[model samples]
Target chain A: MDKTQQSHLLIEDLSVARGERILLGGISLRLSSGQIAEVTGPNGVGKSTLLRAIAGFFPVRSGRMSWVESEAADSAPLAERLHYIGHLDGLKSALTARENLEIGLRFLGRDRRTPLQALDRMELAHVLDLPVGYLSAGQRRRVALARLLIVDRPLWLLDEPLTALDRHACALLKAIVAGHLGSGGLTLAATHEPLGLPGTIQVRLGTR
Target chain B: MTRILLVIFVRDLMLARRIGGGGILGLVFFLSLVTVVPFAIGPDLRLLSRIGPAILWIAALLASLLGLDRLFQADQEDGSLDQMFLSPAPLELIVLVKCMAHWFVTGLPLVMLSPLFGLMLDLDGPALRSVAATLLVGTPTFTLLGAIGAALTVTLRRGGLLLSILVVPLAVPVLIFGVSAAQSATISFLTPFLVLCALGLASIALAPIAAAAALRTAGE
Candidate 1:
């Protein structure tokens, strides 16, 4: 597979289960470059499970999920081309905000902007030196949001990216998602509230 | 790949330092265990020397298990383990890095302080040296085995007791060979030491893959 080719995700009749309980089934979707898909549903409706399955965190009981090149049969592994942000922000409380972002960028193994630049974009420059344990819930969310900007991946799998944010932070997150879409990237976000992004295809999961 | 592993290693070490009582706490626990033995058994120098190697080994083993519960707990709780699972680097490599960091933080201190405890137990020079040698070679195996237990119980809220139960049985071989190697250092030292080395090598090669599989299945 050519490394430069863009990724096109295809999910065909995917089903997921948690122990004896089946969460969601018969789900199918296609996301090409520069597309955004919002997975919306009520609580306990398998919204997070669908995103996790795409991120390879959950096993798909039936059907296939693949990331194929635009013109070739060869496909890239989803893990290499995607970023996943779940309910818990992956931050170490002992480290400063800048330190956490730097570690995240380094772990992603991508050539990208400096951690300070990402934090600055998130309007967290004033608290860059503060340990993440001392930050407010909203500030911590922004720091985690900055992680999405520090690396350049083709796909993003975000679960509830707007849980603890104020109205302004929500607007900031929407703008960040918009910018990611503008740059020919793909986003699959699961949220209870509307993502408020234009042209976003909604995947509403019904409760089991 | 090396850079990413280094970042994780350094981050884990920093957490061990900054978080509540990591390396120092392990050392203090080791010291208290060493100090309490004399009181329990009554102050007898011959008895102390006779049992010093076993006592020191037991203390080191228990100290090594002190921090094992937190091996993956913090990462699992903070959701970093999920991100790590999705990284371009393999999960086995990440698990290996974590185990190495854990050993460095918790196990190395006990090995370094075993000689002091050995002296306090009235061990002679040769006995002290041999106890330290066996501990240095054997503690990593204990740590690697404990990591499998840690990963298996990562999802449980109170996994410390279960971790001890699961890991102690697996660590019996290390304990046996560790004590034997120290006891027979004056005689045929090569055989027991070689067996201990083999156990350590096997744990190094196999534990990470097993632990990584456990971590994956845990999320499922």
Candidate 2:
């Protein structure tokens, strides 16, 4: 795409490493608004690392990851524009599902009502008052996904979001991603299995 | 906001209660140490009284260090620490909130229960008051300094012992002033109290940055 047509996320010749170990080297990709980029790779091919780098959670050892909000070309701070979810679901186990959602909302500085509605949409109302430690793995995963529903950021970076989730939860998450894309929000998700998301653009790493 | 701090403070206290024994174990250890000193000295009440303030301060210092290992370990293991780091609020704010919560659960309680230890150590009324006041100012410094050590060791396999080693030396200045203030309160309180408050304020300004840097190092 031409520069004018690329007012979105661009990862150009990016390289990252941890000490002497190179996590990813000379990788590049671009993601436009309203598009979902599904990153597929082997287990240790630095998929989560890539997502984290894009979200500014980790530094790019070399090269650049740029975000253009509008006409401006320089990249903004990654945290300012993206919502990132790593392998470890970030939920307070001692807190009830509702309280966990509330904390997530406060973190995003979004409305609590929206998070409550998200919990309802996920069909988690029955256990909203139960501490997350009491919930099953699938339920915990759903609570994490509920964060995606309530947060209003334009970009989502999720790693292995479907892990441990049941068919219903998986389908629910896919639908949420689809809705997010339809609303001009972008997504960069890394996963081992194909998510069966319709019209997603796939970026295969490790092999190429 | 104070409300946010209060919520975090209460939550941590509840967790400390449910976990049971870690927070109180330190106080119990402090009590025993204070009581055992008289036995070791062979009925020297004069010496005990003279050294009582310092003894109480040292005991409080060690007791505060008791649960330092768990400051960020549980949160890191559970992924809540990562969430806090990523929250829209600045990471420094999160560090402050977490440290304040920790102080409430561990340090504040020790300060509250310190008078009994003072009495056992034959600390006079003025000395006991000094011990309490110094702890009120000093333990927060202890908590803040311990945060850096906790953050640095949070990801290590052998974290607890290493954290204590790293932090106790850094906390030496605070302990010095803490005990000094308590010991001198019988005759001259103002100078030591001012010095202790200065140490606390300096720590309040610097420790958060150090802790944040340590956390970033651990993350890398």
Candidate 3:
């Protein structure tokens, strides 16, 4: 992955609401270059909601979410600058894994690796030509994660990235995230299990 | 920028060619609708020819709406819609490209085959040609209009029926102009035809914007 130097993410006193109710509130966090924030919380604690909120999928009632790239703030919109891996795997079942990743690479407008190389990194190159529907649940999840490798984005918002992954794939994900962070990329993952990477920031929400 | 839009367009066309996603359903449904009309009118060649333009317009309108119901919903269900939101390409352009591919598969074929459907309904040479020509300019309006309905009802289960209900009423003007233009093959061919073209252009400009707005809210 290409190095993303001097990128930073800061969320201050963020409050996200749904309809008439506030799902979570009073949250604050900062992530500079080469760091990972593991958002851990009990179920229904708005873990996924926070990730979605940052990705601009969920509504934020109050907060100043800003990004600074290369010593200059007010860079690209966070939606275009970040990657969000939600629960749905985000792959079209009719298309092969290679096609899905290629579309992602083009649409994301940033390229780090070819679909072949990205899948191989997750030990999933053999399934490259297979339709995503044919892949098992774990394989599909790994293919979805390969999307992260194809794009060179500064921030990653992952919701339960470890789900359905076997031990090997889980380790693969951790190494991928670690490599990403080492390259000066920032990541925020909502996970039940530990990412087990060093210096992982724990942002627990919904305490109130 | 063109490359990104082309990628989305190609992916959608590929899906629509696949088994369950194929546009053959729309074509076949169109053929069936045309086929049943002759029988319903009891072999009255004069009546069939007289009403052939209306039948073709209505059938094409319904057929084009077939593939649109899943235009955004399938992407939403698979999580690709979120990735789309994150893309540098504008969402309205994305919606337009997807709808273009959709119309290519579902709408274009119907336009090409409508002359044959017209022949089956005892239409004359001029009527057949005019029907095909008008559909080329008109079917896209159905796809564009249906896109709004599709995006509005995307998160709802069984939105296909609701999509029809919502879009059909709105498609009346296009239908009226389309049928009139086709039926006017022997008369002033330019008037209603131009109006139909204007409707197509207007929908092409505006539907994507409206559909994209609806999709933005549906993301939550």
Docking class of 1: high
TM-score of each: 0.97, 0.92, 0.96
Please, what are the lDDT tens digits per residue for candidate 2 over residues B1-220?
4444455556667677666776678778788888888899888889999988888878887888888888888877776666666565666666777888788777888899888788887787888888899999998998898888888898886798898899899888888877877888857888878988998888888888888877766666
What number of clashing residue pairs does each candidate have, in the order they appear?
Answer: 0, 0, 0
Per-residue lDDT over A1-208 for candidate 3, one digit per residue giving the tens place of the 0 to 100 score: 4464688899999998878898889889999988999999899998988898899987789988888787465467889889899899889888899998998899998698999999999999999999999999999999999999998888998899999999989988999998889988899999999898999999977477
lDDT of 2 by residue, A1-208 (tens): 1223334788899988889878888888888877888889777788888887776666678997777777466354667567777877877777788877776766666453565688887878788889898999988888888887776777888888889888887888888888777777788889877777777889888753
User: Interface RMSD for every prediction, one decimal?
Assistant: 0.9, 2.4, 1.1
Models ranked on DockQ: 3, 1, 2
Please state the error at residue B13 of candidate 2 in Å: 4.1
Model 3 reproduces a share of the real contacts of 0.86
What's model 2's overall lDDT?
Answer: 0.79
Q: Candidate 3, DockQ to 2 decimals?
A: 0.81
* Cand. 3 TM to true fold: 0.96
Model 3 regions lying over 4 Å from their true place:
A1-4, A71-74
Model 3 Cα shift for residue A102 (angstroms):
1.5
DockQ of each: 0.81, 0.44, 0.81
